[model samples]
Target: MAKDNSFDIVSKVDLQEVVNAVNQAVREIETRFDFKDSKSKISFDGKSEITLVSDDDFKLRNVVDILESKLVKRGVNLKALRYGKIEPAAGNTVRQNVTLVQGIEQDIAKKIVKAVKDSKIKVQATIQGDQIRVSGKNRDDLQNVIKLIKEMDLNIPVEFVNFRTF
Candidate 1:
């Protein structure tokens, strides 16, 4: 009898890094000449959403760029920041939503399931909550799944953890 091997694949973000990036963006907005006294502001609404308010679309875009730069500096992937459509608000203002997506979205999770099924690998894949777990009889098969996942560009950062030999 041989032991089974298993691992979980997940996409997660470091909240602290996100906070650091936001802080840096605030400092830049204050010092940058273009944004100085521009009446534009950046704030984190709730815990996972970032709201950017500006008088015009151009200035709003600039602020978004500044925030993106900070996120990059903090080693957070740009794809993880999902931006909503810009809309008009009262007092002649424009607002946009920046959602910090920490876990696997529905679409991405489905894609992972489909890819695993199409691979024809002899591993069992189950979606547990927000993540997918893969298990198989051979260690080599599990490693192969990991390699296959790495080869695909899912546009999300995936981490492998809790590997165990049953």
Candidate 2:
């Protein structure tokens, strides 16, 4: 009997890395001459949102750039962040919120399943809550599916996990 090979596709961000990134950004802002006297700050809510505050639009953009660089250096995918619109805050400051994405959205999960089914690969794909599981009797077919998914422009960062053969 041929046992199935399987893997899971998921999109998740490491919250601790995000926190570290924010801390690095804050430290950079404090030392930068332009931000020395300006009110620039980055704060993380520890759950899913990061808040950025600066004295004006220019400083706000600079703050965002610093944060992004730190995140990239930490190997955190930029796609996992959803940036909210910048808005005016108290004391003539500008503020923005960045929401961390933790899972594959339902619509995207459905699209992944449909694409797998349409590809004519000898595999079965099922959407299980926030992730997709793909399984097949042939290990090669499973690898092919992974290649196909990698070639797709899903607009979200995905990681393949739990590769198993039984």
Candidate 3:
């Protein structure tokens, strides 16, 4: 009998890179002419949360844009950054929470599951928490699944791990 082949597909963001980007953005806000005097600031709380504060919504948006640019430069996908609703603070200030969403969202995850099923590959796909595991009897079929997935424009980064042949 042929050995079973399998691998796990996961979508995860590196929190350290996000922290570095936030730090760089804060420095830029401090030195930039328009932002320097706006009292806009950014801080990372906990391991994966970023808080942006500004006097006005416009300034807050500017800070977010800068942070997004920094994230892009660091090869971080913008989709991974989930922004909370902006609200007024105690001092009539606006603040927003930028949470790093490392897991695949439900819709995207379902789309991936459907794509894999539609590919006609002889693999069984199961949603394992935030990731997907694919298994098949033939290694060649498993490789084909990987290749096909790569060709699709999922608009998200996918990492293959936990590969094993049973």
Best model number under TM-score: 2
Better of 2 and 3 by TM-score: 2
Scored against the true structure, residue 65 in model 2 reaches a CA lDDT of 95
Which run of 10 residues does model 1 get worst, by summed lDDT? Answer: 38-47
**Cα-based TM-score, every candidate:** 0.89, 0.98, 0.83
Per-residue error (Å), model 3, residue 22: 1.0
Cα-based lDDT at residue 117, candidate 1: 84
lDDT of 2 by residue, 20-128 (tens): 9999999999999888779899999999999999999999999999999999999999989899999999999999999998899999998889989999999999988
- For candidate 2, give the lDDT of residue 130: 93
lDDT of 1 by residue, 3-61 (tens): 77899998887888888888899888989888776877788754689988888999999
Kindly indicate the candidate among 1 and 3 with the higher lDDT.
1
Better of 2 and 3 by lDDT: 2
RMSD of 1: 1.8
| lDDT (CA) per prediction | 0.86, 0.93, 0.86
- Can you give the lDDT of residue 104 in candidate 3? 69
Name the top lDDT candidate.
2
Flag regions of model 3 displaced more than 4 Å.
105-107, 147-156
